[model samples]
Target chain A: MFSLQGYGPSILEGTYLTLEISFVSLFVAMLLGICGALAKLSGSPVLRAIAKLYTTVIRGIPDLVMMLLVFFGGQVIVNKVGPLFGYNEYIDINPFVAGASTIGFIFGAYMTETFRGAILAVGRGQLEAGYAYGMTGLQVFSRILLPQMVRHAIPGFGNNWLVLIKTTALVSIIGLDDMVRKAAMAAGATRMPFTFYVAVAINYLLITTVSIYLLKYLETRYSVGVRRE
Target chain B: MDFAIIASNIDIYLEGLKNTLILVSISLIFGLVMAIPLAVLRTSGNLYVQAPIRAFVYFFRGTPLLVQMFLVYYGFGQFEAMRESVLWPLFREAYFCALFTFALNTCAYTTEIIRGSIVATPHGEIEAARAAGMSTFLMLRRIVLPSAFRRALPAYSNEIIFMLHGSSLASVITIIDITGAARIVNSRYYSPWEAFLTAAVFYMAITFTIVFFVRKLEKLWQRHLMPLEQLDTKIEAPSI
Candidate 1:
């Protein structure tokens, strides 16, 4: 009989933490992504420049480096900044918060590109048609643009989501008690590195398989009423 | 902010950069070589050939590289049979282990990039090649591969950059790559900003260089295709 023994519960708990961090990061990434896309599409040159720099820089660096820089380097910045605000005390960042925000920030750059492409994929004529009907800008966006954009965005969005979920594993490096770290501990203790890591790999595969199904469902849902070749 | 620390540790960083470049270059070259055949097998008409390739691709793509690296480097060491094997000597070195892992991981991604473009190879061209009495080998060599490779350049460039970034993981296993150097400096001086930001700048420099060359390569290859203006607007999402 195979058993994770007492470590099974901890691994399960780690799985929950991983999921929590991923979903929260996804939400935050979407927010930053949408704003970034808007900024890139906006008329102001400064906004466009900022968005461009953000995406380029994020894309250029590794996520592990970014996570380290943010968690440790960011803590230093905060502690330094805090003293100026009269707090005068060292502050420690929660690994969950750091992990979520860094993951969110990195993926936000990817999402910015995804959303921007999706926005562009929506036909220009649709916006002009809304304007012809005397629809306000906001009205045009909400009524005409969003629904169509969602359909185009789904494929790219799905890809990002898969990558983002896998990226959550990097949080383990920053000392987050995620599944990978838990597996490492169990592997070290039991001297069965292959067994534990294989389990973690299977867990990832299960997440990916479920995600592929859900994404296909989303694609179909958004593709409703559109005639296909 | 602390230029003095950076100035003093510049040699250490440079030494680490040498290792990073070595790791990335060796792995990337080997990875690309391995990926092409895997890609051909992946897009093959024969189900038996494609199935195993698909499984390999899925396994590598699904699992995190950190775990893969760990499994190869640390996990293998736990077994007495592994230690007794002839391959044990190679796996014993962290550098070789990291290189092997990185190469294998990038191979999976590159295979998909190449396979997608190979599958998208225009039907008419193949038909024309057939009509001209070109053999399967000639058709693949002269027509399909060139165009598929050209199309895969942009995506492949992203893969190259990704591998460059991924080489940083070598640091985790105690190899003194750029990130490893940063970690050492940070530990010594307690200056995270100076340490990591310097590594970030070095990575950015390499990224920009790759982007520049890829752009040139695209221009050369895509001369008869879409105009530069149109190509500029085709924003691609960041891929894994």
Candidate 2:
């Protein structure tokens, strides 16, 4: 049958992979973002320099290049290092790992800036107050700074996460069989590029709409005490 | 293979840099010109005029640019009727398709940015212009645009840098920009380290130029808009 029935399941499958990739990568990126922000604000010059280099290089390189490098370069590294590191001889980075890592690396740069700004936005005196309360640095960060930073970070973090989700579409070029690639294949098979592409666009719109609503709820829940103005 | 050996082929990298600059600058200039009216209409009244532009801004902003590029290039290419149309020749040219997509994508983002800036212009200034018997057109020209542009300078600088980075995506549709050139070199030499590294340096250089001008412009605006004494006395703290 020359219809969209078959297309739905394929797209739905791709959507699952896409979500899996984005969620895992975003989790990793969040870790890097916090670490990078702390490093930038740390007293250690070497750590600051290292963090700066990480963000700069990641931002400087195009995502497409980074994805390719990670995918191809990772394969080469794993082949050599896996045996030496006591892993399976045939251990290789699948497309999902490669895509997530590259996208995570790229977005982590942006998230670092977003997080650092959020951290700074939380009043400097707030941290001092935590210290005044006889809390250690670790305690101060967890108890006082982290909560406020989360509220401040939500808006910027949400925007960056949206971009991160869309950026996952680029992984299709590297054999991840994301929505775009599946659409391309289906279009090629059915000779209906416009319809197939529109299907993919609708899929993107659905995911994005759901994400925005979810983020809005989080924003509302987090901003409980503060006046929005 | 020593990475330093790639220096012998600096000429190719320079050529790619030249092309990348061409694509970025051309699209950005045209995008800027397109942004003004779009921004004006976006924040203006009249749902009939504003609704379509709003939808456009949402669509382009909501989706990934890579997919949009594919729609313009491969999606349209698949249409036989479109091929026979007057736009066919233009669309057939990969460079033209790349520029068109870049221009449209940047237009959406710049419109949103410029609209935000325009709306953020102090309401008191507009009221003062009205009280002083200024015409709508005259007030906008004399006060609104200049101030809005100033207000928008910081965000606009980031937009421009992004455009420069975005120009790399043109290579996906077969326009031989810097990234494409780098990929070619990598495949030929089997040394991605050198090729991608060179490309990264080129992007960093472009980014440095963007930041340099942005700093200079910010300083100029800082001087013109607010006196140094007041600026120092009250730093406008960033709110996330």
Best by DockQ: 1
Give the Å shift of residue B68 in candidate 2: 0.2
List TM-score per model, in order: 0.94, 0.91
Q: Tens-digit lDDT track for model 2 on A15-36?
A: 7888899998998899889899
- Model 2 chain B poorest ten-residue lDDT run: B1-10
lDDT of 1 by residue, A89-132 (tens): 77998899999999999999999999999999889998999999
For candidate 2, write residues B45-146 as lDDT tens digits.
599999999999888888888878878877786777898999999998888988998999998999999999999999999999999999988888888889
Writing each residue's lDDT as its tens digit, candidate 1 over B21-64 gives: 99999998998999988898787759988898899899999988
Of the true interface contacts, each candidate retains a share of: 0.65, 0.40
Worst 10 residues of 1 chain B by lDDT: B226-235
Q: Is the docking of candidate 2 incorrect, acceptable, medium or high quality?
A: medium
